[model samples]
Target: MTPKVSIIVPCFNHAKYLNECVESVRNQSYTNWECIIVDDGSTDDTEAVSRTLESDRIRYIHQENRGLSGARNTGIKNASGEYILPLDADDTLNPLALEKMIAVLDQDPDTLIVFSDTVTFGHTSKKSNLQEKFTLKELLLGNKLYCTSLFPKKYFDEGIVYDEKLRHGFEDWEFWIQLISTHRKQPITKIDYPVFNYRSHPETSMIKEITGNTDKKEFIYHAVYEKHKALFHEFFPSYISLLNRKTFYEKKLESIYSSKPYRIYNFLINLFR
Candidate 1:
């Protein structure tokens, strides 16, 4: 029988953590799940690790190195389950995640996407708490609803796939924005409970142009500010409200950096990290 959910995990050079990630899914309290592990041209022993899985519900797909977005697109194209979920190779889901998500989705037939709160863990401590529902505008401005969380399989049937051109980052955010722009009102439900753990190693690094330097951060700040300024105007065509939103962000930036010493310090430190 076809499973109720397909869990797609794309891996590339993550053999060290692949076993644990796959095992977590296999051990899920929700029984009706098919684990699809796409090994995106891993140079490590990822294949051998997956081979160790004994469950027939687990399937492995091998493909060339195609970045995260491309890998996820491939998984979406091949998935057979009614509900689809993307899980990072480095992260592990709580056993009850699928149970909760499926229950919620079953209750609300209109929900196009269902996501739960996440606990982001460093090699040492956990980061901030998970945020609740975020509007399309909020998602476009800042990505609080992380991508690895659950999404409906029908979402892919509309030919909505990740942009492979975005190799480095923000591809998921871009996809969500496109969905909102096209559908006008896509129901994205948020559960307050933690269902996933995002693993963070000490040497973790993002390839975004603005992540590592003060000058680049300034550039990103302006670039994003300008982009969001345009988006705000699009959402609120009225000049007065658009002007107020723009002014709010500008003043908010100044207040956060100047008045909030710890915030500025963290922002600066994030540049090097």
Candidate 2:
């Protein structure tokens, strides 16, 4: 028998996109699944909308405003399946996502996690590499793995979960590190084309937080290193070198943008366009 997949959809103030999100789960070719929608203190019509969608296969759970990490933790704790897929409220999965990822998990005993490439929709159409393997160095540099992916619920039982303290963003990066560090030899596999659709809102708090808040960014960066310093110790020198280079390039770009000639060139180009 095929293993059951429990998709945990965490909804905040996104009542508008709830249907489309749930519809993606219903469309899954692999049908032995249940969707647990954790309404993280949504002030919108999330409850009413959830009520309309609820059935034996689908469930609704409400919690206080505990940010993304807390919401995901709640849904996961309540999940009742061998496999867990964390699907955000706004994003969606391709119909073949469950079928394809589950096949990978079943075929290989070493494989515990399965994810795929990302298809960005809404404002922009783009394909992003969500990383084909889990590497300590790669993840330490940046998070290529997205939040929505197929993982086992066993990890949660073993006490691997998202850190609620890093509330704003990049929580997944931290959590992924913890998950991968425990099982470094087992590489994370990516099936070629079963991509999840990542909805790019024209404006979002996450975008603003990442772009504007340097302090928070620095906090999470240091926090990850501090928490997993043992894993990153060998590559600390190289990581610092890369960080310094990135800072220098950023400053150089800022200078170019501030230059009068560059401004004039941009203005002229925009006017002509």
Candidate 3:
């Protein structure tokens, strides 16, 4: 028997896209699945839109504004399927996504997570491929995994909820770090082709929070670093040393760039160019 997949769509002021998102799930080629629509206190018509779509396989849950992590946590808590797939309300998955990712996990008992490349739409149209292989070291530097990855329900069962405190952005990235580090570090599989469609828009919460606020971005990065400090020391001690050295040089360069002598030198160099 095929394992059932629970697709959690967490929505906040994204009612317009909810229909399309749920429809994509409904159209999945794989038959064993359920769609859980979680409305996170949207001032928009999210509740009404969600109410219209509830059915046997599709269920709706409403909560006061808890942000993305909180909304997802609620959905996960209510999900009954063996596998969990977090699909943002604004995004849609390919028809074969469930089928392929489920196959990967079913075949390999050692693999704990499965992700895929993404196709960007909405304001921008491009195919985003995974530039590097998935490794703990690479993942620490930056997040290559989308939030819509497939994984077992044991994460929730074992009390692993997405960190709701990370409201700024990269909450998913932080969650991934926590998921792999504290848990028994299992192998992850990434499908080569794109199985997810990401909608990129100016109003997107992540884009708005991360744009033009360098200080906030740094704060989030440092927060994640602090949260997973022990994991870093355990897995990539050398990389931690390199990061500290890089920070020292960056501070030194900032001082030099602000000095009158370095400014004069830079002006002269740019004049020649």
The candidate that wins on TM-score is 2
Clashing pairs in 1: none
Best of the two (1, 3) by TM-score = 3
Location of the lowest summed lDDT over 10 successive residues in candidate 3? 203-212
lDDT tens per residue, model 1, 167-239:
6566676666666556666577777667778887777556334455545544433444454466656765564
- Candidate 2 yields a Cα-based lDDT of 0.86
- Candidate 2 residues lying further than 4 Å off, grouped into runs, are 1-3, 237-245, 257-273
Error in Å for residue 234 of model 2: 2.9
CA displacement after TM-score superposition, residue 49 of candidate 1 (Å): 1.2
Shift in Å, residue 165, candidate 1: 0.4
Evaluate all candidate structures by whole-model CA lDDT and list the values in order: 0.75, 0.86, 0.85
**TM-score of every model versus the real structure:** 0.79, 0.89, 0.85
Write the residue-wise lDDT of candidate 3 on 102-140 in tens digits.
889888966778888899999889987775356777788
Model 2, 1-273: lDDT tens digits are: 333888999999999999999999999998999999999999999999999999889999999999999999999899888888999988988998998988888899578678888898997788886556556777778886888878888988899998998886899989888998888888588889655899988876685777577777767787887788787876666665666787689879999999999999999999999
In candidate 3, stretches whose alpha carbon ends up further than 4 angstroms from where it belongs are: 1-3, 183-185, 235-273
Error of 3 at 67 (Å): 0.8
